[model samples]
Target chain A: MIQLTDVTKQYPTKSGPRTILKGINLTIRKGEHVGILGRNGAGKSTLVRVIGGAEPPTTGTVEREMSVSWPLAFTGGFHAKLTGIDNLRFICRIYGVDFHDRLDFVKDFSELGAYLYEPLGVYSSGMRARLAFAISMTIDFDCYLIDEVMAVGDDSFREKCKVELFEKRADKAMLIVSHSHRYLKGTCNRFLLFRDGTIQEYDDFDEVYEKYKELLAEPQTF
Target chain B: MASNSLNSSSEGSFRQSLVVQGRVLHALLIREMLTRYGRNNLGFLWLFLEPMLFTLAVTALWTATRTIHGSDLPITAFAITGYASMLMWRNMPGRCINAIKGNTPLMFHRQVRPLDVYTSRILLEFGGSSASFVLLVMAFWAFDAVALPEDALQVVVGWLTLGWFGAGLAIVLGAVSEKSDLVDKLWPPFSYLLFPFSGAAFIVDSLPDKAREILLYLPMLNCVEFIREGYFGTKMHAHYDMPYVIVFNLVLTLLALGMVRMHVVEADYE
Candidate 1:
């Protein structure tokens, strides 16, 4: 189980301090698949980052009772000059895996072909995404923090991933952040809507979708 | 064996994890070297090329000045011994200063401790510098430029001591820079101040009494004194203190380890 009690996050802007999360109280249980929805600048990324332990809240506690795989496709953490094989070995070493034992498994799972021997700087977006996803899946964590960075991969891989990540790992909790309603509805069991520094949970995706449509259906008021 | 280890059936699996982490640190060192040298056709030759070129330039300047300065050795030998040792000490702390912040991605792996990054960098610098030292000795022999150390063990002890001293200081600077901007601003001045004590261009025996007394307290001077004793076959004139170097380095290493432990490992990226 993961719990956040009275979590708050504030950022200093040119104008003044802007509060992003104000006293957010949340608890996510095992076997839960949650989708976070908010318009641009609604703190969706900030919320996930806080949960992943990438950022700490200003005034609250986050208690994670299970291990988490954070943002499976984040490229910011990799050394660009390293070959994919070396990167894989480094990641394996860091994760305490016997890299030589899993070498073939990682190679086959990534499907990176000859390009795996080349420096990662030479990889295309899709290839890098494949590598990231393959590496994260190698370790079975109790929860996964998913961002939409994997959307660039081809359709077949996406379908395979959806099945493996959601259906196969149904026991693992998921917090998915994406702008696509169809994608969220298909993968998630519940919706979390953020507005004005507060989060409102919707037990049903349909109810949140209806409200989202109604909110967007009106003409511009600004 | 695989089944026992894989299933955590072996009672020693916990200890084995530390070995795995060390190997991980070694791999990171290899990655750093490959990225630094760039896979040009020259390949690993640049490792030797860099220190050799610097040693030669300094040798030329010393010869032109014709200053033997109380040492019974030739100018090339003095330059080779002093400059090579200084090169190792000089480069390590500078490299370690940014080591942690540079590998931000490695921190994401929960198994990769921040201390591992520092260790990998120190080892890599040590390897490169040690190689250069051996290569210089070989080059001197091939050219008949210098004779073997009178007592080779002292030479080895001195170099090892100097390496640890550099590593200790590297740890301190690495930790200090992570917390404040002062290191970046003060580093050049610090380097300049250290230049006199580093024994780069001059032998320690050349200094006056007051100067020699002050210079003897510097960690690098003990190293140079010990190394020069091996080269010149005299008790190194700068007082050659061993206990001081060891104690100072141990304190610095502990301080660095403490600073590293205090870091959050995340959320401080900016």
Candidate 2:
């Protein structure tokens, strides 16, 4: 189980302290699939990072008993002059995986083909995304946290990701952050709408998503 | 209870996997050497040659001075041996400090520990500098220019001490550099100041009385003196204390390792 008790994060600014998350009391049980829906600048990414252990909460305790994987943001590792195959092997070595099995999986799933033996830095943004996604999905984790999931790669890659990860890895708990209601509704049964400085959970995603959209659509003169 | 998480079956296996990732660090070091020096015909040959050239220049200049501390030893053999060893002492620490910032991309890999990056650079610096020393010694022997050390084991011990000292310094410098950008400004002048006290061009015994008393206690001076003693077969003008260097480095290394654990984790903060 993962629990956040009375979490509050504040960042200092020229004006004063800007509060991000205030008194965020939450618990996620095993095998729960969750979608976190929030507009830009609503602390969605910060929540994901904190849960992933990439960052610590400023004023509250985050207790995690399960392994967590955060969505990959960048692809390049050291020795950019090396080929994609070489880089994969290097990463596998670091991660302590048997090179043959992981290598085959990455080669097949990433679809880099002849480009596999060429320098990875030369690969396009989509190719890099595919490679990062393929590697991250192959790692088994109890909790997978994703941010801006719909923005990467193409439509086919997205569908392929859903089939390979969400479908195949159903027993694992997941937290997906995205603005697309259609994708969230299809993939996630539960939703948390982040607004102002706290998260509000809703068993009915449609109801929460509608309210979230309505709130976002109406702009003020402030 | 805390230990249970660390001792999990998967965690044990995961920790074991880091050993494999350490090799990637070696590959990165090779890339660092090549990219910095350029892939010319000379390639890595310069790693050996640079120290040798410094040794040769220092030897010639000191030889012209006739006598050092009224000792009759050939200044060429004395300076060359000491100077070459000092390179190993000096370069490793400086390079290790910059290792993390240099390979920032590798930090994203869960398996690539921060120390692994520094360790790779340390290994490369030691290997290159050690190779240069050996090559220079062999060249001198091939031409019947100088005699080998009387106690080969003592020379090896000296080299190891110098190496650890360098690693310790590098670790602390690396940690401090992350917090403050002052390392970039301080590094050049810091290295320049190290030159006079390094026991490179002259033996600790040869420094005029007052300077000699202070220089003998400096960390690398013992190793330099020890290496020179091995080559020259006698303790020329002063005796060296080895225990001081070892103890000081061990404490410094432990402190550095702690600081690294704390500061390095901050880099990944979201």
Candidate 3:
């Protein structure tokens, strides 16, 4: 379970302090899938980071009872000079899992074959995304942070991921951030919309998405 | 692990935090080694070999100009002791400054804190320089080019003290450099500028009382003087106060950890 109470996050800007999340109070229990909807610059990513324990809230508290994965498909964390195999080993080491056990799984899942022996600097974006997804899946986390960054690979690969995540590990908690209403509607049991530094909970997808469309049409304002 | 009553990782127990840090450091150490050396010929052996080669060249150069080194001390021994200590204190900070900026991606993992990043680099540096120093000393000893130190215990203590100083400085500067661009720009030149006064080139015993007093204000100089005393024993008079060096290291470590905790925010996260 993850619980956030009176959480606020802000960044220093040249003009002044820019607040992102404001007094956010939330609780996510086991097996809950929460979809987050926000336009660009509305702090969906920050909220995700805060929930995953990657970033501390500016004020108030965040309590997590379960292990949280890093943002899915975040290739940024892998060292470019390390081969795909080495990077996989590194992830395994940090997560306190055996690398040899996961080696075959990743090799089979990522489909990189001999390329896994080559440096990540040599891997294309699609290859990197595949590698990232494969590596993160090796770790067992109670909650998975899914940013839109996961929107990669071909349709078949997406289908494979759907089976792995939505079907295979459907009971795990997830906080998914994306602009795709169809995807969110298909997967999430709960919804939160970000506006004016606060989150408004919505149970009805059609109602919240309609509000989201209206928000998109409105003029940009802080 | 989750069976414990404590739910929040941020507020997790001390033992849990330590285990996590150890795991992160192990992962980071391997990552640092591979990224630094790559799959090229000789690879991570360059860790020791690079420093060893530098020391050997300096030893040869000093031997060629034997008369100019300002003391009757064996140039090879002096070069090994002096250059190895210098390499530790010098490069650790260089590796640390802007470390977080280069490693912003790693910060995405909640387990990879700023201290782990600084420590992994410092450990790699300490290991490389120490291996180089020990290898050079043993190799030269085998060849009858230099005698081993008179007091091995004192040498070990002095080397550890010197390492503590480097790690403290690196952590502090690494944290500070993230907040200001000036630190990144200034650190390289400052490291070079410190070389002459760092007691890496000349013995503290060779200097006049006044000059030695002034130079000893620098901690690395005092550390080398302590080490040289271990090496040369009664042959050379070493000037150092262990208490002063220890206190400085303790305070610097406190300040470093404090600054890292207080100052490091998420780097460029939107």
Candidate 4:
């Protein structure tokens, strides 16, 4: 289980302190799949980072009773200078898993084949995304926090992810942050909509997505 | 209770966190080694050799110049001890500053805190310089260019004192560098300015009483003097106050950890 109590995140700018997450109170029970819908610059990523324990909140507390995986994202985790294999090894090392155990699975899942020997800097964006997703899957966690979930890879890769995440790991809890209504409707059992640095929860997908669409069409306000 | 979430209640037992941190540090060390000295000529050999080569070059240049310090201490040993100490303290901060910029992605992992990143660099710096110092001294002894230290354990303690001071300074400066770009820019010239007064160039005993008083204010200079005293023993009169360096180091450690806790979590890469 993961619990966030009155969490707030702020970033300093030339103008002033920008409060991104004003007060977020949330809880994810065992094996619950939660999806968050938000437009750009709405602090969706910040909330996910806080829950994933990658970034600390400026105020309040987040408690995790079960192990949480790192924020699985398209970018901003892998060291580019290291080879794909080396990055995999590094992740395994830090997480206290044997790299040799996950080596085969990542090799087969990423499908970069020989490219895995080369530096991540040389891989194309698609290859990098595949590698990132594949590597994250190898680590076992009670809950997974995914950032920009629907944006990475292509149709086939998405299919692979669906099978690997939903079908294979069906018992695990997942918190996915994305703007795609269709994907969220299919994958998530509950929904959270981001507006004005706060989260509004909804159990029905259609109701939340309708509000999300309204938010997208709403006028700009700071 | 108000506490940083990274070290908060839900992160499991303290022992478990230490185990995780040890694993993270080992991963970071290997990763740093690969990125810094890739698969090329001599590869990671450059870790120790780079410092060793630097000391050798400085020693040769100093020998050629023939610095006469009134006392009859071997110039080779003086240069080696001095240069080695300087490199340990100097390189740590140099490498630590802006360390977040290059390794920002790694921070996405919850275990990879800013202090951990700085620590990995510090360890590398310490390891490299110490290996260089020991290897050069042994090689020189083999060739009969220098004698071994009179008190090996004392020499180790003095070296450790200087390293501790350097590590503390590096952590403080490294954390501060994240707040302002000026620290990164200012540190190089500042370190250079400190070299002439760093006990590398002259003996504390040889200096005039007034000059010695002023130079002793430099903690690094005092440490260098201590190390030399350990090496030369009764032959050279070395003046240093160990308590002073320890107190200064304690303060630096507090500032460093406090600053890292406050600001380092906010670090992000563009």
Instruction: Give the least accurate 10-residue stretch of model 4 chain A, judged by summed lDDT.
Output: A66-75
Candidate 4 regions off by >4 Å? A73-75, B1-11, B101-104, B265-270
True contacts kept of each: 0.25, 0.18, 0.48, 0.48
lDDT by residue (A112-202, candidate 3, tens digit) is 9999999999999989988999998998888888999557987877787788889999999999999988999989989999998899999
Candidate with more favorable, higher DockQ: 2 or 3: 3
DockQ of predictions, in order shown: 0.30, 0.24, 0.43, 0.39
Worst 10 residues of 4 chain B by lDDT: B1-10
Winner by lDDT: 3
Model 3 alpha-carbon miss at residue A65, Å:
1.3
Every model's TM-score: 0.83, 0.80, 0.92, 0.91
What is the TM-score ranking, best to worst? 3, 4, 1, 2
- What are the runs in model 2 whose C-alpha is more than 4 Å off? A4-26, A39-42, A56-63, A76-79, A195-198, A207-222, B1-44, B56-80, B98-112, B143-146, B265-270
Q: Per-residue CA lDDT of candidate 2, range A111-191, in tens? A: 878888776568887877787787776556677777775588898988888887778988878888888887888778778
RMSD of each: 4.8, 4.6, 3.1, 3.5
Model 4 TM:
0.91
